[model samples]
Every structure is written in structure tokens, then in C-alpha cells.
Target chain A: MTLTINDFADLRSAEALEAALRAIGAERYHSNHPFHHLLHSGQLDKGQVQAWALNRWYYQSRIPMKDAAFMSRVVDPDLRREWSQRVVDHDGTREGVGGVTKWLRLCTGLGLDEAYVRSEQGILPATKFAVEAYVHYVRERSLLQAVASSLTELFSPTIIKDRVAGMLKHYDFVDEATLGYFQARITQAPRDSDFALAFVKQHARNEEERQQVCEALLFKCDVLWAQLDALHHAYVLEGGIPPGAFEPVREQGRVAA
Target chain B: MTLTINDFADLRSAEALEAALRAIGAERYHSNHPFHHLLHSGQLDKGQVQAWALNRWYYQSRIPMKDAAFMSRVVDPDLRREWSQRVVDHDGTREGVGGVTKWLRLCTGLGLDEAYVRSEQGILPATKFAVEAYVHYVRERSLLQAVASSLTELFSPTIIKDRVAGMLKHYDFVDEATLGYFQARITQAPRDSDFALAFVKQHARNEEERQQVCEALLFKCDVLWAQLDALHHAYVLEGGIPPGAFEPVREQGRVAA
Candidate 1:
């Protein structure tokens, strides 16, 4: 919990680097955010949950694009082959069978229109910015940093588990079919993270490089955390939604703990 | 005040296109945002103002880069020559006197550490995302749409005047010297917007193109509006700052209006 840039003062062992990356998740991942807390505890109503899901769909949809940006910069066939799995996973081998589709299903399961969500016309500007920043980071940063950023996947399985369980138990609107996206992620995240973490630990050969690795994770965490922050401010807190963002039809959606 | 995508049903006269663009500004500009209201009225304390100036420094700093992105894709020498002036204005003819440097001076004037501000280590992720999105918008969109987005400058003179006048009047820590950046922008923004507007008016050759122009401006409006939304949420409202964002040392900064 007390890791810092100074802690990576020397070239760390592979085990040490992995631990540092995990420590980052322990401290900064979106699972620790209030919106997720509300979400997993069933403290949020369907409309509030809908806002989170709708905004989140932007992040989900951008994953493949982000991966593609990363892959385009890479010259190694091995890395490209491994990285392309992510794009295929979300986009799927066939239509209506991928991570993006499942998330869309969750949105519709919450009563949002499919076209509106697909159009992304209602997404918060902050969401677009945050997700696009992730894509750009992958596109533009060092290959080590770009791969290090995906280490968020290391922590995703648990968050997905908590989210699926919480939503199913708390919201009448949520069901297994609707929540399949997270279910799929439980397996998918660990697989992706393993690849990324191994690549990072091996590729990041110096203390300075290790520091960048930590910063990359921290930035990625901020990307995920900020998306939820936008949602929490817009939907959970008194901060009004930004104009042109999604406005839920129903007002009273939170269930008191 | 009521306008919709339907309003661009015909590619009206150039005068009509100008009216609709102005109407978009009337209805959607950041001048209508509450954060500006707070800023213009001196309702924020030095710390809140610091957060605004510091975070806004990201937007201010990105202008030259955005212009350069816009200029990069211009195939016409006339357009490129005209557009490159924006870069010169922000970057200045010589070292240390451009719009970007002035904004940096404002941050230093606000009691934030010059190096820390320059590092952008403490900036809200939302600010980075929003500003970078603007730069990307310029880089990737149609040249006409990219120019149309700059039309937020169309409304900047009034906001800058109100801000300069109000901050000088209300905040003890502020002086005309620190606020000189806004004074410079008053001339700069209008001149840039006029050129952008004329380009949009002439180049948008049909109803669909005009509609795209309107949508681009709306997107630009959302970009400006969303930056304020993040500031208000993080600094003004109860929404806590994201991990690693600039946190003002003194919390009680908002002045009673």
C-alpha cells in the first residue's frame, strides 16, 4: 500500500514489479470508487445504474480501438498476435456475441434504447474524453507504458464479480443475460492482464522504466476512476448532468441501505 | 432558443448559417455554465480559482498544438498561412512571451508551484481528456468542421472581460498583471473565430454540410461546457477530487455572492 516512485529505486525483480502493479490496483482501481460501491451494494436505482452503464459503455466500446492503436505501433508479430485477441474478444468473431454486444444488452436490459446508446449522442463529454485519452495513451506512449496500462485487467475479475453479484441481487432489472459482459470479463481480464504484466515485467528493464510502468498504471487507474467520478457527479451527487449527456426518465432509483 | 438538427433543412444564405452558429453559442456556450458565473462574480476563493486556472492551463496550453494539428492537414497555402498565425499568437515570436507563457504566469500568480503546474502532475484527468479531445478533433475531423469548432472563440471576448473585471475586483491575491492573459485573449479569440466562421460559412456547401458545421460547433460547445462541469464537480461541488488531481490546501475558498 505504501509503494512510491522511490521504491523502484533499483531494477526490481519480476515478482517485485508485479507486486508493485498489484499494489497500484489495491490503492487506485475503480472498484474502490463510490459509484462502484453504490452499484455493487444495490444502493443505486435502475436509472442511476443505467447512467453508469450508459457512460461505461463508451469505455467498453473503445477497448478494441485502444488495442488496435497499440498493435499498430508494434512491429513484432508475436505481440500483435497476442494483442489482437483483445480486439477480437470485444468485437467478437461473429456479430452480437462479443463484450461490446453484451454491454449493449445490459443497457437495453435497463430500458435504454439501443440506437441512442450506440450513437453515443448521450454520453458525457467527460466519458468521451476519458475513454479517448486511454486510446490515445495506447496509441502514443512507449510500448512498455502502453502494455503496462492494460494491467488494470489484473484487477478486473474481482470487480466484475462484485458488480455482477451486486446488480443481480439488488436490481430487479438486472439478470444473468444482462450481466453477461462482466461474466465474460472474469475470464477475459485475467488472460489479458497475464500477458500484459509478463510483457511489462520483462520489457521494463530499468528503475526509470519501472517508474513509468507504475505511472502508466496510475494513469490508467485515473482513466477508469475518472469515468466513474463523472458518473457519480452527474447522477449520484447534486452536480447536474452536463448538457447533451444521458438524462434518465425516472428520478427515484437508489435503494436505501 | 429552440433549434434542432431539423433547422438546417436547407443550406440557407450564409447570413442564415451565421445566425444558427450564433444561436448555438447563445444556447450552449460555457458563458452560461455555473463555474463561469462563479468565476466572473468572484464567488471562488483563491484556492478554487487556483484549481480553475491550473486545470484550465491544460486547455490554454493545448491551443497552439490544436492549431498546429488543424494547420497540418491544410493543403492550401492560403489556409495554412492564415492558420499558422494562431500558432504564432499562442507560442509568440520569441521565447517566453506567448499566450501559453502568460497562462503559466497566471498559475504562478495564483500561488501554485510553477514547476508542479508545468508538470501537470496535479491536473484533473478530466481536464487532460477534454483538452486533448479538442486537439484530436482538430486533427481528425473535416477541415471545415475543425474550423467550426473554434467558434467558441466567437463568445470569448465577453467572458474574458467579465472574468478579468470580476477577478481583479474580488480576489485579493489577483492583480491585472496576473490576469493579463485574459486581456490578450480578448483580441486573439475574436480574430480567430471570425476567420473560422468565414471558412465554415463559405465551405459548408450544402444542407448536410451546414448541419455538420452546426454539429461540430455543438460538439465544441460540449467540449467547453464539459471542462467547466469537471471543475465545478471536483472543486466547487462535494464531488471529491480524483486521485492525484490538484487539491487546494485551503478548502474554504468560495466567497458568498
Candidate 2:
């Protein structure tokens, strides 16, 4: 989020702002993170994959709360109405099906315990921090910035496709059924990002506003990237699991990369 | 911070509470973290050491703020006055020398840029979460729990001893002058924790209170431990530095570490 006033001269138009935001996703998004490559290419073992899903469940679990936080700050009934759909999308109807539910399915598919995933007991503290920071960012920052942070969805579809297809194709334990979360996201992310992208592009009236918009996206990218960084560092690089985090139960969970 | 009602039986007495807190420290303190092992024994490289100092500066920088937060909730002027010394210890007199200033000396001695360290631009996001979570913990938890969180200071004297001695002996870049921070801490931590420990012991009225006291210390241990986890994860384990974190400058910075 390092935008200075002098560095702010070029993003005065919505076209330029859109280009800048897309450029940020292209450059800084978590898709570019190595963990994603490891994940998408089936380079990770079952434990690493389980670690990814369990930790990611924390992020997925928090999405509705982040949206609820964003909605809490909205004074306009119209904005709040539009924002409530994100909550509905994540929390689902009274049927109790949502992104978190589907994510738990994925975790179960990876051989993670559903109750344990729901309990969030074993996730890394960094995951808590990064995800909680996202909630805080929405509650504390401007409405426009809150809207802009969700713009990462603009880039999620391709990653979702790669992730779903990659998991199914490579990992024998995972089937199309387990990747239901990504399937929902495939359509949902574009619709959500279309709305958020237009909001950011339309409301960022000047260079400073545009820069703040870009910073919000950058901040969101860091949030996603940092989670993987923690996972990779703890599980892959050194296995220095913090005290009280989940230890994976090994099974037919890994796919040969 | 994972203390439940059933895990509550053992910590019933003040003696038991004190023992529990210390045991938690013995088991969970950052001193037990391998990053500290690497750091204390001179197994880390220059970049790792600089990364440690720089990232730690963020925590050191927040100490007075956390103390002031604890002080703010105090209604008893006597208690407030006793607590004010903590603020004074870190913030110092108008002479502007204190723990943070001393810590910057340590950082600068390790060849880190003083401004960059102060800017906190390169520290891990987990460091922010862990540290900010400390501040939030002080503000949001019960006053007794807030004081109990400082109980990690109970174990700090020895780590300070080991850190000072080990760094000086192992790392050529460090000397006594650079480690003024720990020298102050060597006295300050025990005094502060003595007051806090006494407060926790005297005031924890029941098994539930004692359990919470233990939980606070455990949470503080997590706070400290999580920062090192991030440092180890980013600098030592994988060098997978998160985007925008500090990159160390090479000089006569590393010993065998």
C-alpha cells in the first residue's frame, strides 16, 4: 500500500485506475505466490495440501464476517442491500450451505476433520492475523477501500479453474465432488468482482483516491500471500509448526507432482 | 490461550497459578523457539540476524503503547502511578533514551537502517498481528488478564541474559553498547513482572481466574512465539520474504550465525 502523492499523478481516470488495479493483481496477487504453484501443480504432499485447506478454511470462514463488517459501515440502504449478497453468498440460505460449508467439504475430502476445521484450532496464528486483518481492513477503512479489497476476486476465477482441475487431475484422493468450493467461486467471483471493480473505478474520483484504491488491493494481495507464506514456511520449508496448530493425519492425501 | 474449564483443576491455588504460569513459560516462551536457538547460539546468518532485529523493533516499538493501554484502564491512581513507570521505562525522560531507543541501537549495530527499522515497513505481517494482538489483548481483556499477559516478562530476565551474552560472544557485530536494551530489560522485566505476578496471585480469586491468568500468559507466549515463527518462516526457513518486507544489507554482520 506504498503510494506517495508524487507517485499518484497517473491514475486520474477510471481507465487508468482499472489498468493499475489489474496490473497489481497480475504482479502481486497470491496466484503469483509459489505456494499456489506448488498447490496447483500437485507439487505438495498430502500434509501440505491439508495444511493449505485447513489454514485457508480460516480465510474462507471469515469472508462473510468481512462482508458483514463492510455492510455495518454502510449508511445507505442501497449499498447495504447490494453488500448483503456477499454475506448470503458465503453464509448461504437457511439450508446452512455456503463457501465455508463447501470449504469444509474440501477439507474433509483432503482427509481433514470437519469439526476440527470448523473449530479453527490448528490454523497458524499468522493465518488468524492475516485473515483477521482483512476483517479489520473492511471495518476500519473507507467504504471504497473495503469494496476495493474484494477486487482480488477479479483474478480468482482462473486460479479457481486451475486449482479445481489441477486437484482433480493430479490428486487421486480428490474428485470433482471435493472441489465444489472452487466451482461455486468460478461464477461467483466474477459477479462479485464486477460489482466491486465498478465501485472502485467509479468512486475513486482523483489520483489520491485511485492510489488508495490500488493500495487496498495491494493490501488484500499481501493478506492472501502472507497466509500461503506462513503455510509454506511452517509446513513445506521447515515444518516448524507453532504450538497448538493442527498436525495433519496422513492418508492417501498427496498427489505426485 | 487454550485453557478450558476442565483444564482448570490444576491451577487452583496461588502457588499453583504461579507454577502454571512459569510452566507455560518454560514450555511456550519464545526462548523455546528454534529461531531463538539459532539466534542465541550464533547459527543464523547476517541477514537472519538483521531480520530478527528489524522485525523485533516493531514489537519493541509497541511496548510503551501496550503499557499505556494497560494504564488507561486503571481507575486506582496508586495502581496507575505504579504502572506509569512502565511507560517511563520504555518512553524515557525528555532525554529521549529508552528501551526502544536502545533497541534501535542494537538494530543499527547489526547494520540495519535506523529509519527503516523505525518505519516498520519490512517486518512480517504476522509480527503486526501478533504485536497488535497484544495491544488489543490488553485493551479488550479483563484487567487481571491484561496484567497476567505481562507475566511472560517473568521469564524474560534469563532470555535477556542468554541473548546478551550469546550475541556478544557469538556475533562480532554486537558489543555491550549495542545491547543497552536488554541491560535495561534485565532489571525492568523482573520488576514489572514481579508486580504483575503478585497482582495475578493476590487477585486471581478462584480456579477460573487462575486459569485465565494462565491463558493470558499462554497468549502472551503465543504473541512472542508467533513473531519468531514469522521471522524463522520468512528469513531462516525459506527466505520467502513477503512482499515489501525488509531485505538485509550485508556488512560485518554475521558470525558463524
Candidate 3:
């Protein structure tokens, strides 16, 4: 049951490679993580959900920056045109817009202060590390791998659908307006992922290049999954949150206003 | 109790501020983390230990780069003279003689391939993130806080004592020969941390600057702790190691020679 890059080369076509990559997503995506289960099932208390939103806002905010960084490295103007839309999508034309602005609304809906979330004063260190890892991955790796890694967008729609539905059904606080980010992503992610997939598939000519593409997707999956793991460890299992990260509800009032 | 930077402004002397900083170290440093306990107690298997060595090598390797970056920022000749030694200490006069070279030997001592370790081919994404965070930290933060963050070295000797003794006692494979890095650190860390502490206590004048210093040290602690957390999750708890990182002992023989 062990998978390696060597197994990727035998993939005869992009279809086969795409299927294997989706298989990896099904098996290992953050949706399968326990924290997501808690999130959807409404098992997490308000504070936990707040922590999730606040920590996740950091990730959401950085996406466009990373995408821009990735876009900056691409040589082709045509390709750059496709990738630039992502930055526009995440950072909308006006204030109180874009994915990041939407994510901040989710934090506000969860009862977190906008300033605290923006300050990143209350998010977990693990969240920062995980998110920054993705940024660094895109910046340092080959442009092909950078584009390929964003292929996690390939799987985001299903999770978003489940998440929006589950949050509506399970959590009282997260209403349609607060969860609007998912609505945009349902379309935006597929559009983005499709372009990226075709780009990677066409460009990766050799076995080594193909393997790098596959591995890039896998690396990104780890980045996302690792974010959840840190949340689970710090906020769930040990109940030992790092200093200056999100404070639990019972302890929130104690930290200075 | 939560600590604040304003309290330091009213301090009686530089020694008081230094004590407060050390006190922050006593409370918040990585020594309190469970992974450190697991590492020092030898509860980790050889593969877990190998993962530690492999990931930590990334941290070790970057110290010179960070030192160089830090040195590049210092304008004072006196400070530059003192800071430049750190880069020399890490890089050494010759290629195979410095801290990085010593760390490579530690990796090889733990059964890693020399070329693979030196190439940094298999390091965990989280490890790279943590180290990159450090380099970026030194690059972006106020010079005073950046110096204070290195104050973790002030606490390093004690952890080094525990790590060296416990690693040697419990792991039949470890020896003074393999862990010679810590022996050098025993003397060097104190000398380094002392200078850093002196620098921070003298330079951090205002409440905001003082708070920045405190936060920087905490940030550095998180950097160190997150590295261990990532290694633990990937190699031990979650059980999915990243591609190109250390293979478990069972798989090592199967990897290409």
C-alpha cells in the first residue's frame, strides 16, 4: 500500500495520473482529519470554532500573496493572465470583499475581533508554520511544481459543499453571509485547478517532471493536513495552546482588552 | 501570569530586564514541550530519532545563513566585529570544519546518506518552514528583537546537557563522537546568549521595542518547538512521512544504494 514517485511514472496518461492524485486526495485530505469532523459535526464549542476561523484567516489571506508570488515566476503572459485572476479573486476590488475579507467575516461571525484576527495575535503557531510552509514551497520550488501544488484546488469544491451544508445544519452562528467564501470557492477553485492541471499535464514531459507534479500536489496536501494536525494537537488533544494564539472562551476575558 | 513589556521600563537595572527575559525563557522555552521529553527519554525509536536528526540538520545548516543575514544588517563596527564571529563559528574557516559540517556528520552518524543529507533532498516541509521562518525573522524584525530571539541560546546549555546525557544513555547508537556538536555548544551557547542578552537589554529602550523583543523570543521558541512538533507528527504520530525525508529503518535498505 506504499506509494512512491516511481509508481507515478507508470501512469500512462494524464487521466491515470489525475485519478491517482484524486485517490490521494480522497485518502489524505484535511476533510478526513478529526478537526474537520469536529467542525462539521458541531462538536467543537464556539471558542474552538473561533480558533479555527481566526487561524484559518491567516491561511486564506496568504493564498493570494503566494499565488501572486507563483504568478510572478511564470514566464508566459498567457499563463500569467490565468493565474493573476486568483489574486483578484482572493483580494477583491473593494474593501469588505475577496476571500480574505470573507474569511474575516467568518471570524467576526464566530465572535472574534477583526483587529485580533488581522493582527494574527490569536492564531496558533502551527497554523503560521503550516501556512508559511505553503508560501515557501511555492516560492522555492520549480514554477511547474508551484502551479501543480495548487492542484489541491482540484478537491476543494466537494469539501466546501460539505462544509457549507454541515455548518448550516450543525452550527447556529455560521449563517449564509458568513460562509459566503465557500460559495465563491465552489466555482473559483475548479476554474483555477482546471487551468493548473492542464498547464502541469502539458508541460511535464518526462517521468521526472511528471513525478514532481504529483509530488507537489502531495506536498500541498501535507501542508493543509499538517495545519489540521497542529490544531488537533494544540486545541483538541492536549488542550495546550501556544502563547498568544487563540484563547479559549473561558479564558478569553482574562487576556487584555 | 501573562508578562508585559511595560513592566521592564520601570526596572531597576539592566540585570533585572535580563532576568525577566531569562524568566520568559524558563517559562516558555521548548524544554516544556512533550517531544523534548520523548527525545531526551529515548522513548522514540531509531527511525523517530533519525527523523529528528534529519530535520534538525536543516535548522543547523541555516544558522550560518541567518548569521550572515544578521551580520549584513549590523552597521556598528563593534557589534559587527562581535556578530561576524557567529557566522565564522557556524561556517568555519574551511568547508568541512564548521557547525554545518559537524551537523552533517551527526546526520550520517544516525545512518543517513551523506550526499542526501548534504543536498537537503529529504527534509520535512515543516522543518524547512521553521528554519525559513528563522531566517525571515532575522531579516524582517527590528534588530533588537532579532538579537533577543537568539537568547534561546541562553537556555540551550541546560537542554544540551539533558539531551546529550539522555541521548547517550538511552540510545545505544549515540556517543560523544556522534554528538560532538553539543559539546561545542555547551561552551559556545552561553558565550553567544550572554552577548545577545546584553545587546537586547541595552538597546530595547521603549515599551513597544521591549514587547517586540519578548515576542521575538517567543517566536523563536515557536520556531524550535514547531520543528519538533512537525517531526513528531510526520514520523511518529500521524505516520505519513514526507517524500525524500528519512525513510524508516525497514525501508532504508530498500532505497537505492
TM-score of each: 0.93, 0.92, 0.86
Candidate 3 per-residue lDDT, tens place, A185-221, comes to 9999889888988888888877677788888887887
Q: Candidate 1 at residue B53, lDDT?
A: 88
**Which of 1 and 3 is the better model by lDDT?**
1
Give the Cα lDDT of each candidate.
0.84, 0.82, 0.79
Model 1 residue A205 CA deviation in Å: 1.7
Clash pairs detected, candidate 1: A45-A253, B45-B253
Candidate 2 TM-score, true structure as reference: 0.92
Candidate 2 has which clashing residue pairs, if any?
A122-A246, B42-B257, B44-B257, B45-B257, B122-B246
Model 3 preserves the real interface contacts to a fraction of 0.25
Rank by lDDT, highest first.
Answer: 1, 2, 3
Off by over 4 Å in 1: A1-11, A250-257, B1-7, B250-257
lDDT of 2 by residue, A6-47 (tens): 344699699999988877787778898889898888898888
The digit string of per-residue lDDT tens for model 1 on B1-257 reads 34445565665677788888888888888999988999889899888899998888888888888988888898999999998988988899999998899999998888777777777767888888888888989899999889998888898898888888888888899999998888878888878888888888889888788888998888888888878888888888888787667778732231111
**Residue B103 accuracy (lDDT) in model 2:** 82
